[model samples]
Every structure is written in structure tokens, then in C-alpha cells.
Target chain A: MTMLPPPTSKKLGLVIDLDICVGCHACAVACKEWNDGGQFGPLPDANPYGAEPLGVWFNRVHTYEIEPKEKGAPAMTVHFPRSCLHCETPDCVTVCPTGASYKRAEDGIVLVDEDKCIGCKLCSWACPYGAREYSEQRGTMQKCTLCVDRIYNESFEEIDRQPACVMACPTRARHFGDLGDADSAVSKLVAERGGYDLMPEMGYKPVNKYLPPRPRRDGCAAEPTPAQEEKVDFSTSPLLRWIDKVLSR
Target chain B: MRPAFSVIFFTVMSGCGYGLLFLFGLALAFNPAVSGRIEGLVQLGVGAIFVVAGLLASTLHLGQPQRAWRAFSQWRSSWLSREGVASVASFMPMVLIAGCLWRGADATTLRALGALLAAFAAITVICTAGIYTSLKAIPAWHNRFVLPGYLLMALLGGAAWSWLIGEWTGGARAQPALIVALAIASCVLKHFYWRHIDAATPASTIETATGLGRFGRVRSVEAPHTEENYLTHEMGFQLARKHGKRLRNIALLLLGPCTIVLALLAITFQAPLHWPAACCAFAAAILVTAGLFVERWLFFAQAKHVVMLYYGGARMHDA
Candidate 1:
């Protein structure tokens, strides 16, 4: 029963743009807020009021500083948000001893059937992305369900049908669409921006993609050009000169 | 990689139990030393206690202990499930063999069942080792040495306990040289395993992790969260180099040369000083078990998980 299902053609996933992300914890916080009220609600927080508070979160944001290759080049800061990739060959699902952890065949969204989970914690270990979170209170494993409830809800508006994290992104750095469709908007963005997979050598074949930061521009190149200075010259314009004389009177 | 006490105890105690049971089963099948009732009682009693105690200890880490029976359902894909099924099946033949000894039955049934128990125990140990080796996430555990190292330690522990039983029951003369040889072999294999892991490189680097390999260098400017999360807590355990070296030395001394010396003394004075021989054998068995525990602890503490790259761990290749 733990054997993986055949590969599906439709892979629903997110595309994260590193260039525009502002290192804000909005995505992480939005994820927690929405999921806490939806399926797998109320992510347990043990010792929340104590000196050391601990809780489970499905998404996390990390920041990194990449030093420039040239001596005078400026350093770049990259904010990385990590979550479940819903891999094509998820080791977490295969390593599971119970049928609780499984991938959906219809949409390729990996989910946990909490009713059947034994809380063995093997799935968490098998995941390279640290996607699965163990809830001691529920005695089951939880992870990003790609907002299956909201995305598939018929009552919601078309624009409100995306994941909470994607909708809440101020810069629109997070995008949700059918990554399996090469002609989809998300896929086109990936192609244009040179989007890449994280740790591709791991061979999980992650459905999610990340767009690398664009090349940094030089400091002086942003200054005004000589061509712009030729415009709005009062000395060369007769209308501007007449307006200046009338204002002086 | 937290080296939870429950898991450490489960692996060590169960390994020793399986090891001891294996030797007793082999002896019963090939030789006729444990034909007497008292010898059979002592052998079965020790083996059952260690094995059962270990089995119980393994459940301590489980969040839902009552649901453990469900683990046996997926033996085809899970080594843990296979271990559960194999270990439970082994007890069937073991208990039946014990019953035969209790009733003074024929040796033929006992011998055949004993052999079956031996095979099952070996398989269970292998399955347990496979649980760690099969993990591609942890580079240190996913190696050629893990399987052989586990088996060697099991054999060594079993041989030591068997020698003690032989001395106490006066049923048979255990070959001390064989115990010493197994101890030596385990120590040598452990040394090579340490060297191999030390020299090995991590499969992925920080650049590869971020898909920024085209860029020159990448470093973390800030952490995702201020507080520790499940991933960090479970996999962030770090063992200091000094402590690791000291523990390795202690384990080597206790398991290798010290055990060899005690075993040699027992062999030299078995006839003239039976009391001293029994005492020495008992002490050596205790030392070997303790040493193996330390070794297993290092095995977990020293492992580096790939998830650490997201945290502030230096490049995986740097190790």
C-alpha cells in the first residue's frame, strides 16, 4: 500500500521568485494562519507561554547573503522560503510504514491521512526539504497540502482560489499554477527567468521551481543620462521664457 | 540525529539479545552441551529478558505506542516492518524450543527449532541495520560499513554473553579465543568505518542546495526562525571533536584490548580458578555491552543530515 502511484501529467506546484522576495515572514505567517483554521487546524504549540516555546509550521523562510565574485561588486541578499515540493518520487511516502502518507494521483498533491498515521516520524526524516512537521498532540505528521481545500472550493472567487501564501505575497513572489503544463503562465515565467530546482541531485524531481535573482546592476549605471538633460531647458524654450517673465511681474 | 536514549537502548540491548540467542541456538543445533534442564533455563531466561526488554524499549519513542501493531503491515517496503515481523516470528521457535527443554523432550526437535531461531535472529538484526543504511538522507549511515559493523558487534556481544553462561552453568567450555577474535574484528572494522566516514564528502553543497551553483559563494545572513523548530531540534545535534575522540578511545579500550585481556585470563585459569574465570567473563560481557552503547551513540551524533545546509552549517563538502 505504501508503493507510489504512477506518475501523473498534472503537477500543481508553486514558483518562488528570489529576486523580489523581501525576507518578510508573511508567507510563513499566512500559511500558519490559514492552515490553522482549515484542514489540519490548530498546529499545536507546546510550552507556548514558557521560556522556550515550540510549535510546528509547514513553511519557513530563510535568508542568505551571497558575496560578489569581483572585488568591487556589492553583496546580494536572497530570501528563501521552503516547503514541500510534492516530489514525483517522494521518499517520505515510500518510506512510510502505514498508508497514512500518500500522494494524490489526480492532482499530484501529497497529503497525510491523519486517521491512519501512527506518528512514526519516518516521513519527516525521509524528506530532504524538511516539509513534514510532526504534531505530538495529534500523533500524526502534517505538511503543506498546497491549500487543496481553498484551491478546489467552488464558492471562492477565481482570484481567491490560490494558496494563502501566494495570495498574501505583497510582491507576488509566490505563484501557484499547473507546472506540468509547459504553456502555463508559471511554466513560461520559469522558462524566461531560468528557474531551477533546489538540490536537483537529490533526485526527488521536485515539482516546485525557484527563479534565481537577476544580475545586479552597477552603482553608477542607475544615475541620469546626458540625453535626459537636454529636455526641460528654459533657456532654449520661448514659451518657458515668457511664462518666467509673466511670473516675475 | 538526536541520539534519543530510547533508540540507543533499543538497538544495543536488542542486538545483544539477538546475538546471545543466535549463539545458544547454534550450539543447541550443532553440539549437545545444553541438554540439561538448568542450562536450558538459564540460556532461555537471559535471551528472553534482553530481547523482550529491548522490544519494549523501542516503543518508548513512539508517539502512538498503541498503534505499533500497524507497523507490521508494510514489511515489503519498510525495513522497520520487516524487523517487527521477523523478530516476532523468531520468538515462536524460541519458545517452542524452550518448552521442549522444560519437558525433557527429544533433542531432534530442539535442534531443528534452535537452527530456525538462529536464522530468524540474524535476519532481524540485518533488517534493523538496513533501516539506517537504506536512508539516503544521512551520508554517514548510508555506507557499506554500517551493515557489517552492526553484525560484528552483535556477534561479539553474543559471544561474550555466551562465555559467561558457559562459565556459570558449567555446561560447556566456551572458546575464549573466539570471543577475542570477534572483538578484534569488530574493533578493526569500526576503525575503518570511522576513517571512511571522516574522509567521505557530503553529497551536496550549500550552492547546490540553493540552486546557486552558478554563483560564486552563498552564505546565510539570517535564520528562518529565532526559536528552534522540529527540523533543527531533531537533526541539529552536534558532538564536539574532543568529546567524540575521548569517547571513541574509551569504547575502543573497553571493547577491544580490555575484553581480550579478560577473556584470555578466563581461558588461562578456567581449570585452576573457576571462580575467577566466571567473574572475569561476567565483567568482560558488561564492558562489551557498554562499549557498544557508546559506539552506537557516536553513530547518531556524528551523522550530518542534508537539511542542515538550510541552517548555518558550513558547506557540506567542507566536512
Candidate 2:
């Protein structure tokens, strides 16, 4: 008898704040570090320094400029960073010809068993997210496991076990927690800030929620204050005096 | 939707094999009181060879062929699983009935079992077709026309096979008429499937995919990556537009009327048992099967998966 895997409560997911992300690609590098160290092994590279360098990576941060308004963007550019949304109804698992791909019944994290994978590349095709990357050297599939090996390690401190991207982010844009639990930090954050998922119409019901960029403050003045004179000596350069005279004229 | 060669071969060979048996089923059913026991045995015996050969070829594609039985386990949500289950289940009864029929067992029990095999034969044909029809993601495949198209194909393709066997042992009396009708129907079906798929809106437009408004201006200025990725290799097979149209027409010409004429020629010469008709029909179907493979390839290649929008293929069309 076959049964659909139970939907789990310990839903590991990410909350990405579009407001603070600067597209530094730290998360992508952090992800590669952890995935390489754990179950997925090293993502091999072909022609590392040659004409066309290629390799498998579980995460690749995409940068896209947004106007966000009809007028050309007056403010700094809004960079969009994309990764696997870890959708609740991931089509990749169901489309697998082998049982190597599965959704976790414990944490709602989708994963592929590298040992059982035949490298047929069907899961990659099935995933509309383009989440799964094939490791050509290993001939197996690799994806963000939600840092399963780190999140559950008994040796690490409770807070230290979160995904490397979440821990390493300097701007604090990425939040990690269980979305299924109402009292969880992510759920509260989502409820308060009006967080939204990307491409919700796709109906994947993505676990990760993106907090839309907050609207800029109105009536904010832009000026250079007189306090600037405290640090610089105007008498130092004749060129500076000439610029000041030209400004006054 | 990956154009795996093994799968293409599996579908074609099985389709032809199943078609031949389906015609044999109709012939046995058409004559309730016929007394050609030795001849019936030979026809059934020969047809089974093609069926088994096609099925055996399919196993070569499996990664872990030893675990092939596990495919039957997940029939609930999976159409591929159901196909494997139905195919294996259908094989058992067919073998039993054919084995008995070949031994000249025309008893009431054997005849009843043979009828059961015929019903199961239809199930096998439909189940095989269901593998593609069930995929809701591929708009070209998941449609109303697929069900009847497959059923019609089985009956029509089966007619040619039945005609061959009928000429060999049963006589060419009713086989030619069945082939004529089947040929026309098959031609019409292929046309409808092609037409419907060509005109349908892509499942999602680039705007809808990118979360832009339906009428939003979206275009791909630059691709995200320099080299092709796994997603592109597995899904991004593109066929030239003009060539596909020409090839589809070529398939109809080669497989459709060309086959019917050969069967008709065999009829005119009173050489139903002659090699020309069977040879021509067999060769034409193989060519058409190749053509259908290309058609199936285009079905996947032409489909714009929603994710392609993110990598700057955000071109929008009228939904």
C-alpha cells in the first residue's frame, strides 16, 4: 500500500526581506560552503580557469533592477535575489521516476537522495523553480536541503545551527524558522509586515515568504549640513577657494 | 517532458505491437462461429512475438531494472505508475489466452478468456496513452482529444495488424474494409491533435509568470547564464517552425494513404497472404512512429515552462 507523505509541522523555511538585500551574493557563497561540507559533497567545476567555467551550485542569487515606479528610479536600485522557494507542493518530487526525491514528513523540506538518484535529470525538468542542480562529476542531483545537517546537529548551539546564509547575512535580510507553527518568529513577522510569496499564482504554496520593500518616507529633506566644516580646513587648498568663489558668483 | 530515446522507442514499438493484437481481437470477435482452429492459433502466436519484443526493449531504459516492479506501487497519484501496473496486469491474461489459443483450445472457457484478453488489450493501449495524457503540466498532451485519439489509433493501427493475420490464416474477406476505415480515422485524428496543440495558449504567459500585469510589457533583453543549464538541456528543445509543419505533412502522406493503398493493392491482386501489403504497412507505421516521436518532441520543446521567464525570456503573448 502506498501513501502520500504526511505534511509536517516543523516546516523549515526562509523569509527574505527585499528591502535590505543588496545582492552581495553572500547567501549563495554561504550555501555552497555548507552544501559542499555536508551530504551533497563538493560541487565540481569543469574548466575552472578555462574559456567557460561550469559547476553545480545549490543556490545562485539573481540580481534584477526594478524601477518600482513609472519615473526612472530616483532611489538606489532594488536588487532581487532568487533561490528555491521550497514550495509546499513541489512538483519535482512527484515527477521523479525513482523514489530518490522526497518531501520531508518531519520538516517539510524537500530533498533528493543522491545515493538512489540515477541522474536521469527528470526532477530538474519537473522543477519550475530550477532549484535542483545536477552534479556532473557525481552524476546526482543537489539542492538546498534547508541545511538539514546543520539545523539538527547536537554539537552546535541552538541558534548557531540555522542556515549559513541566515547566520552570515550582515544586513539581516534572511530569517529562518517554522512557518507551520503560529507562534514561530517567521509567522509573527509575516503577519505584522504583510509578507508575500513570489509567484503565488503558480500554486506551489511556497514556504518562503518575501517581505515586500517598504515604501520610502515622504517629505524627507536632502541637504548638506554646516557641521561638515568641523572636520575640513577650507584654507588648505587654493583650488577649493576658487570653487567656493565660483559657487558664490 | 525530457525527450528520452528509450521512452520514445518504448511508446512506438508497444503502440504498433498493441495495435496488431487489437485487430486480432476484433477478427476473433467478428466471427463467432468460424471453424479455423489451426489458423487462429498461428495468427495469435505470430502477433504475440511483436508485443513481447516491444515490451522487452522498454526494460533496457530502466536505471535499476531489478527494481522495475516497484513502479507498480504508486498508482494512486501517478499516471506513469498506473501505466506500469495496468501494462503488467494486462500481460498475464494475454499470455494465458494466447497460449491456449495457439494449442487449438477453442472451448467455451478458452473463447471467454480470449474475449477477456481483448478487453484487457484495450486497457493496455489506453494505459500506455494515459502516461502522456495525464500530465496536466503539458497543455499539448493533457486535453480532451488525447483519450479518443489514442483509442482511435489503437483500433486503426490494430486493423492493419489484424488484416495481416487475417490474410495469413483467417482469409482477407473483412480485413481490407477494417483497414480502410481505420486508415481514414487515424489520419483525421492525427490532424486534430496537431491542430489543437498548435493553437492553444501556453499554460502561462511571461507576464503571469513574472508576476507582472497581464498586459505588462515584458521582454528578454539578456539571458541569465552564458551556457545552457540542466533545465534547458532537459526541457529547452526547440524545433524550427517551418520544418515541423512540413514533417507532419510528410508523416501523414507516408503513413496514412500509402499504407491503405498497399493493403488495397494486396486485395486487388488476391494476394492477401502476399508480402507487399504487410511489408508496406509495417514500414509506413515505423516511419509514422518516427514522425510521431518528432511530434512528441515538438510538444515538449515548444512548451514554454513558466520558469523560463525568470531567466529573461519574459516575452509576453496574448494569453
Candidate 3:
């Protein structure tokens, strides 16, 4: 039962744009909030108010500073959101000793059947993305389900049925749809933005794609004027001069 | 990469057990009259105890210990599952061989059962090695050196155990020359393995992990969380170079020169039932086991998982 399912035509995944992300951590919080009480309820925190708190989370956001290639050019800060890629040939599924980890053929969604999991933690070791989270309290492995319960729920409106992370993005940096479909909006976005996979050499063939940050045009290479380089001068403004005199008196 | 005590104990103890089983079976097949019935039973009993204790220790590593039986169901794909199956299957032949020894069976019957037992034991050890080799996420484990390292170490430890048991039971003695040779081979293999990992360049880096290499030199400015999470807790263990080198020296000394010297001393005292020979062999066995424990700890502690790249690790090797 740990055997991977045949490749599916419907490779539903997410496409994130790095240019607009502000590192607000709203998406990660949304994912945790939705999953905590949803189908995968009670993402237990070991120490809520203690010095060291550990818990399971399906998504995380990391910030990286990219040094500019040209000297004197300002560096760029990119906020990267990390989560499960739902790979085509995931070793995490095949490495399971118990038939706990599996991928669905219908939509290419990888999931862990908690009931069958022995909590061996092999699947966690096999994952290069660090997506799988083990719950000590429940004695089971948990991972990003891509919001399986909400994605297909008929009761919710079509617009509200996407993943919680996508739904909560303030800047519309995240998009979700069937990546397998060439003409889909998400696929078009990927093609236009030149979206790329993380660690492609690993050969997992990750379904999720990330759009690179756009080039900056803030004239970072321009030289500063002599006046700009000088220390604080009240001579440029009368209000600042009056305030400085009053303070000195 | 946390080097859990339960896992280290399981691998080291079980590997020694399988090695002892293999040697015992080979002895039974080649010379059925190597020892009396009681002596044979005692040898088999010790091996069984080590194997059973190791298996029990492994269950402690699982969160759902009661559901450990479910692991045997996925042999079609998983090496861990295959290991479970092979280990359990090996007990069948072991029990049969034990029964044959107990009844004082004929040489022909004992030979066939002995061979079967040895084959099962060897297969189980191979399955154990396969578990680490199959993992691609940890480049340190996914290497050519790991497979042979596991095999040679198991045999070396087994040879040491055999020498001690032979002395204790006054049965067919495992050649001291053979133990010396195995110890040398294991030392050489470990040296190469360590050198290989040290010099090898990591396949993945933080730049590639974020797919932002085109921008410039990418470095993590902030982590996902301030405190240690599961990923950091499990994979963030960093063994300092100074400590690692010292431990490696200790392991090599105990496993190589010291063990070889003891084995040579045992060989020098050629007289049968000599107390000095027995003492030397016993010391060699203890040293080998202790040495392997340090080696196993290094194996887990030094492995850098690729996932660390996302959490500010510059490269896989650096992590």
C-alpha cells in the first residue's frame, strides 16, 4: 500500500510569486489556524507559555537577503514560503514501512493515513523539503494535505474552496489551480513569470512552482551628492533651524 | 541525524547478533562435532538474546510501539519493511537449527539447516544496510561507502564475538589471523568512508534550494521560527570538527590497532584451554563493541540532511 500511484493528469499545485511577498507570515498563520481545528485538528503545542514551544505546522516562511551582483547596489530581501511540493516521485511515500504514506492518482495529492502510521519517522527522514511533521501526542505523522477537506467541499462557494494559504494572501502572491493543465490561469502565470522548481537537481519533480523576484529599478547604482553625504544640517530648512536654536537655548 | 540511543543500540547489537549467528551456522555446517550439545545450545542462545534485545530496542524508537507489527507489511517497496520481514523470517531457520542441535541430529541434516540459517542471517544484515543506502535525502548516507561499511563492520564485530564465544565454549575457535584481517579491513573501509564524506561537495545549496541563484549570493536573514522546531531539532545537530576528529581517533584506536594487538596476543598463546588466550579474546570483543558504538554515533551525528538548506544551512556538507 506504500507503493506510489500512477502519475495523474490533474496535478493540482500552488504557484507563489516572490516579488510581491512581504514576509507578513499571514499565510503560515492562516494554514495553522485552519488546520488546527479543521480535519487535521489540534496541531498541539508542547509548551504554550513555556520557554521552549514546539508544535506541528504545515507551512513556514523564511526570509533571505540576496547580495546585489554589482558593487554599491542595494541588496534585495526575498520572503520564501516553504511547504510540501507534492512531488511526482516522492520517496517519503515509498520509504514508509507501514502503508501510511501514499499519493492519490486522481489529483496527485500526497497524504498520510494517520490510522495506519506506526510513527517510525522514516517518511520524515526521506523528505528533503522537511514537510512531514510528527505529532508526539497523537503518535502519527502529519503533513500538508493541500487543504483536502476544504478544496473539494461542495458546501463552500467555488471562490472560497482553495487552500487556506492562497485564500489569506493579502497581496495575491499565491495562486492555486491544476498545474497539469496548460491553459489554466495558474499555468499561464507560471509560463509568463518563468516560475521554477526548488532544488530541481534533486529530481523529485515538484508540482509547486516559485516565481523569481523581479529586477529592481530604484537607481541603486547612482552616486550620492555632496550635500546628501554631509551630516545633519538645519541650514536647508528654517523650521529645523528654529527648533535646533530653541533646543540649544 | 539526532543519533538516538535506541537506534544506535539496535543497529550495533543486532549487527553483532547477526554476525555471531552467521559464524555459528558456518561452524555447525563445516564441523558438526565442534562442540557438545550444551555448548552449541549456549552459543545459539547468546546470539538469540542479542538479536531479540536489539529488536525490542528498535521498537522503542517508534511512537506507536504497539503497532510495530504493521511494519512488516510493506516489503514490496520499503527496505525498512524488508528488514522487518527478513529479520522475522531468519528466526525460523534459527529455531530449526537449534532444534537439530538439541536432538543431536546427524551431520547431513545439521549441515543443510546451518547453511539455511547463515543465508537468512546474511540477508537480514543486507536489508538493514539497504535502509540507509536507499535514502537520497541525506547525501552522506546515499553513498557507495555506506553499504560495504555496514557489511564489513558487521562481519568484523561478528568475528570478534566468535573469538570470545569459541574461547568460552572451548569449541571450534575462530582463527585469530582471521579476526586481525577483518579488523584491518574494517579500519581501512572506515578510513575511506570518512575521507570520502569529508572531501565530497554537497549536491544542493541554499541558493538552489530557494531557486534564487539567478539573483545573486543568497543567504538566510531570518528563520521561520525563533525557537527550535521539529526540522531544526532533528536535523540541525552540528558536530564540531575538533570533537569529531577526537572521537574518530578514539574509535579507530579501539577498533583497529588495539583489537589487532589483542587478537595477535590470543594467537601467540596457542595452547588449548589457556586462560590468557581467553582473556585476550574477551578484551578484544569488548573493545570492538565499544568502538563500534562510537562509530555508529558518528554515522548519525555527522550526516547532514538536504532539508537543512532551507533553515540557513549554506550547503549540505556544511549543515
Model 3, residue pairs in steric clash: none
- Measured as a fraction from 0 to 1, the native contacts recovered by model 3 come to 0.86
**Tens digits of lDDT, candidate 3, B247-278:** 99999999999999998887787676599889
Q: What is the TM-score of chain A in candidate 1?
A: 0.89
| All models, RMSD in angstroms | 2.8, 5.2, 5.0
Ten contiguous residues minimizing lDDT sum, candidate 1 chain A: A220-229
Fnat value of model 2? 0.10
Better of 1 and 3 by lDDT: 3
**Which docking band does candidate 1 fall into?**
medium
Lowest-sum lDDT 10-residue window in model 2 chain B: B207-216
TM-score of chain A for the candidates in order shown = 0.89, 0.83, 0.88
Model 2 over residues A1-249: C-alpha lDDT tens digits? 223366777778998887788767788788878777776677777776777767776766654444334343333334455667777876667756557778878788888777666664556655666777777677777788888888888899998989888887889999999999989999999898877766665566788887766766653233535665444466988999789779768
- The residue-level lDDT of candidate 1 at B12 comes to 90
Give candidate 2 misplaced runs (Cα > 4 Å): A1-3, A42-55, A65-82, A118-122, A134-140, A168-170, A214-249, B29-67, B165-174, B212-224, B240-242, B263-287, B314-319
Steric overlap count per candidate: 0, 1, 0
**TM-score for candidate 2:** 0.81
Residue B101 of candidate 2: its Cα lDDT?
60
lDDT of 2 by residue, B1-319 (tens): 3556666666655665667655555455555334265565555555566566656666665545565565665566555566666666666756776666656565665556656667767777787767666554455666887777667655655555555556556442236656667667777887887778777766565444444332134444444456766655555545434366676776577557776676677667655356665565555445445545554454554554545556664431222
What lDDT does each candidate get? 0.85, 0.64, 0.88
State what share of the real interface contacts each candidate retains: 0.66, 0.10, 0.86
